[model samples]
Each structure stands twice: as structure tokens, then as C-alpha cells.
Target: MTDPVDRDSRVPALVRLTVDLSALRYNYRRVASVGERTAAVVKANAYGLGAARVVETLRREGCRDFFVATLSEGVLLRAVDREATIFVLSGPVDEESAFAMVRHALTPVLNDATQLQWWRAHRETPAAVHVDTGMHRLGFDYRSFSASIFEGFNVGLVLSHLACADDPPHPMNERQVARFESIRSLFPDAVGSLANSAGALSGMASGMTRAGIALYGGNPFVTRPNPMATVAVLESRVIALRTVAAGEPIGYAATYTTAQETRVAVLGVGYADGFPRGATRDARVAYGASRLPVVGRVSMDLLHVDASTVGREIALGDWVEIFGHTIGIDEAAAWSGTISYELLTRLGGRVARCYTGS
Candidate 1:
């Protein structure tokens, strides 16, 4: 629980997403030990934890491979770094964006036979081919994979995505693995890759695994332990505090009525800052060492919490942890009825991210 900011130094008032760089490095190294090269997925700004900084840190930690979801993200990641192996997961759509892939030196994951053909016709650099076994979002159909679609291009990695690896013993787990293994033999020169964070943790094939959410310490497979670093916590300042009489309504539409004479502490964070609106009266914000229950409904700019039991020392300008340290991301996601990955990825750009440790 080291202080995120320099307590003795002066800094501007802003929402800070304090990141533990050391924890991230430790998680990458730990996940890489599973006997395969770990490609850090920096898609969606590294799941809302700033892609540029995430790639920079991971690169320094010896991560040579990186994955981004979109062409734009690939461009931004390439801007930050040029030497690392940056792969675009969306693959190429047409000739226009394909040139961007070449310009940025991004290796597109060819998902379909058409894109494969498109790349084979227009692409000059090495590209990865995605074969769909299940989780039919991207990648080529199981039937078309054996066609001449991938004949001429220099394929870097024969990739497939995992859908049910989070379930561990899910029937689809072995099915997709078997399918990927079967088809991968067709392309001998290309390296094989299967497994995401969950796949790697589930003892899947020993190929390159793309570590995304788990690298940031989220367990997609809740049954098993999270195989990464500590959860990232977020804290914001309480800008105001006041006493409300019993039966007084709070927030818009008078959704929450105060039970008794209550003390409310207003936090600076709100939905616009990526705090979910569903985080209503059930959510709790941590103040100092004690947890204060958020009363009433969450608003766009602020949320109120009961702090009557909190001492008078707690006042305006005091800091309250919204999701990190005590209130884990899992709890926050549960309260919001979403996964921790959503919570992390939805963290808005308005909130400033501050990095700590090496």
C-alpha cells in the first residue's frame, strides 16, 4: 500500500490511475514461465491501463511480442515502439488499411480466407493466420483453413483463439485445441499459437499465449486462482461532505432515500470517469482505513456515501479508494454485474494514470 503520489511534493488536483509497474513485470515473467513466449496484449489501451506505458514497461521487462485489437491501436503502439513485434488482432480489411499495417510494421492476424487472400495479394510483410475452432468471432472457418488461401504468404504464426479455456474442463477447450493442432500441421513453416490468459493457465497447448486481462491480475476463470500480479486499485478525493436529515432523497429522480440522519461524503469520481452507473447504493468507497457504504444512486459527476461513523478528521479533500487496495476489482465487477475486464477497459481517459515502481 505504498503512496501513489509523492506526499511531500506538490501536484495538481486530478484523478490518478496509479499503476504498479513492478507488479506488471512480475506478472509477465510469471506467466512467461509456463514454457512459452508470452505476448502482452495491449489492446484497449492495455485494458484501460494506457497502452503506450504498458508496452514500454513490458518491453523493458523483456517482452518482445505485443498484440493490439485495432489498426489504430497498432499504429499508436508502433509509434511508442518500433523494434517490438506488434500484431494487429483485427487483421486487415482492405487495401487502404493494409498499407498502414506495412507502414507500421504490424503483423496482421489474418482471420478469414478473404483477408488471407487479400494479404497474400497485397501484403509484403509476414502475417499471422487465425484459424477458428470455436468462439467463432475471428479466424478462418475450420473447412477453409486447408484451402490454398494461405499458400504464398510468409506466415509468422498460425494462431487460434480460446473461447472456453476459462472453464478449464469445458468440452470446447480440448475440441478447439485438437482442431488447432490438426490444422496447424498444414502450415509447417509458421509457428503455432493458441491460448489466451485462461488458456495458458488451463494447461492448454504449449504455444505462444496472449496474456491480456490476467496480466493485469483479473481471473477470467473464477474457479482457478488469478495467475498474475496484484489487483489495481483506484482512489479519488472526497470534495465535499454534509449532513442529511432522515427521509431526505439523494441523487437524480430521488432514487435513494436516507434511512436516518446520515453523513454523506461526495467523491470526485462518477460514471463519466468510468465508474459504472449501476454502482448504486450497494457500492462502498474506502476512506482512510475504514470502508464507507455508498448511499443513494450514482450520478454522472459524483456519488454519495454514508460516513456518519467516520471521524470528524474525515472531511473535504480527503482521499477515498474507489476500487483498489481494499475493494478488489472482482468485487467491483460483481457489484456492477460485469467482468473485471470490462471494469478495467471502461476506465475513461479523463482519469489520469500515474505509474509507480519499476
Candidate 2:
């Protein structure tokens, strides 16, 4: 079937997202290596990489449990694998969605009394109960917590989210753990879970650990070495090249000026392509072993990078790695003062995705 990851560099894709499934699987094992029952969070289109393809790869690696944020995500996942455990993290809203959850055998992670009541009305399968730890985003609080809330339904998992799992020493981590432990203890029959990607590695997660961003090559530890292999590679084609003399202005409103005579490579990607409008630090692109600085304001469809350092070997249509095996997403995200998850999810649909290392 002509491999979907078009290895041919000649193909004219302005921007390409190379998803290394091998690295993804390796990352899965890396997170799983900590010995916690691991569940894959394949929400947000598997963090903007094609969920179907990524899930297919993970399934082969023996990942049977998956988590999604909404009914639509659960529905799409149900199409991918029928027997795998699919938990709708967002739970159900209306009667229709609750019924849809039952009909598909998809489990809902009940967050509040309304959702709990809604799921109970159409309970055909087991569901997860989310307890609020510290994020205050979803899950039940002390006011909502009651044995009667789960009285009649089958509770499969009792879980909570950590507001500061990325920062290991944060006091909120211990607080969430204590709260989550207390809630999980109330349900002896269901599996207890309180760790996310970072939680799993921290060795504090109980029962089952749910992994999200780390499974996709993101380093959950903000200040530590990324233990996982690089999984995502973003590359853009060099469509145009030019020479700008010293003090010459580049890009919109002359946001950047050339320090000396500089060669510029204008790539076919921009904020519209999920390249981060200006989140990049030093505004550089990778060429061979050299780093080319971005010399202008990032535009909607294009961005200019100074190639005077390695302009001799560069050519039109040659692919330049933006964030890849050599460049970590966290590193790039740091330059932009954002997290890897945001950069990964914010990646626009304009960029073509090609899976490799399957």
C-alpha cells in the first residue's frame, strides 16, 4: 500500500510530521518500565499525531487500556480497537451521550454528581470515578463524594489528576496523593490510580498509572534529562533563499535586522502550521549539525531563518528539521516558554503527518 510515511524527500509537502512509532512504543515501555499498570491517554488526536495510527502501533505493543477526553474520541477509538478498555475521561453530558456510552461498551470517568447520575441512568458497563485532587478542573470534591454516588454501578477505576506531577518536589503532589489514596481506599473493588506520566516515574502512583504526554516522547520532568526517546520530528521545506546585507531588515515591521551579510532560508511553515508564532528561542532551524537562527517575526505561512552559517550546502526544497531526533520538543518548547504538550497539540492540520518505524 505505498507506505503512508512517504520516505521520498522529493514529495512536495511544505511541512511534515514524522511520527516514529518505534520511539512511541519505546516511550510506552519507558513509562511502563516503572512497574505501574499503564493506560495510554490517546486524547487530542493522540496529542495531534494521528490517533488511529498511534493506537494501532501501541495495541501491537500490548497496550489494552486507553483514555480519551470525550464521547467523540471514545467513539473514534472504538472503531480502532473493539476489545481494548476505552475510558471516556470527559464522561457524558446528556441522555444521548450516556446512552451512546452504554451502547458502545465505552466506560465513562464520572466527574460529578450530574454525570454520575447521568451514567447511572444508562449503566450497561463499568465506569471510572474521578476524585478531585488539586487541579480543580474535573472530578468530584468532598461535597460531591459519597458512597451512595457509586452505590448501584460498577466502578472500574478510582483515579485523580496531579496538578504538579511535572514538578516532583511540589507540595501539591503529596497533597493529591493523600487525597487520592483516601478516595481509592473507599472503593476496594476498583483499581486505584493517581499518577500521570510524571507520576508513574515518581514511584508515588498507586494501583494503576495513567500515562499521557510522556508516551509521546515528551519529558514530563521539567528540569531533568528526558529519559524517553525522541518520537516526533517536524521538518519544513526550504522554498526560497536570499542574501541580506548587514543592517537589512527582515520579516514584518522589520522585527529583526541582519548583523552582517546573511543568507536566509524561508521555510514553508509558520504559526498557522503549528510552528509556534514566536515560541522558539533564538528562532533557529536545524541543518545537518548546524543551528540556523530565525531572523524575523514568524508569519502565518512562512518564517525566515539565517542560513549564512551553512548556506553553502543548503538548497531549495531541502527539508530542515525543526524539532526532531537531534532537537527535543521540550528544548524547543522551553524557548517559547510553553510546555511540550501545548506545542504538540497546537500543531496545525496543515502539516502532513507521516508515520515511520512501525
Which candidate has the top score in lDDT?
Answer: 2
Q: Candidate 2 on 1-358: residue-level lDDT in tens?
A: 1222335666668999999998999999988888558889988889978888888888888888999999988887898788999999999998789999988889999988899878777654799988887788999994457766577788879888899998899999988888777777789899988889998887776678888989888898987788888889999999999988999999888878888999999999999988787655365679887888877888998979988888679999999988977677888887788878998888886778887898
Least well predicted 10-residue stretch by lDDT in candidate 1: 1-10
Q: Which TM-score value belongs to model 2? A: 0.95
- In order, candidate lDDTs are 0.79, 0.84
Cα RMSD to the true fold for all candidates:
3.5, 2.5
- Model 1 TM-score is 0.93
Q: lDDT of candidate 1 vs native?
A: 0.79
> What is residue 332's positional error in candidate 2, in angstroms?
0.7
For each candidate, what TM-score against the reference? Answer: 0.93, 0.95
Off by over 4 Å in 1: 1-11
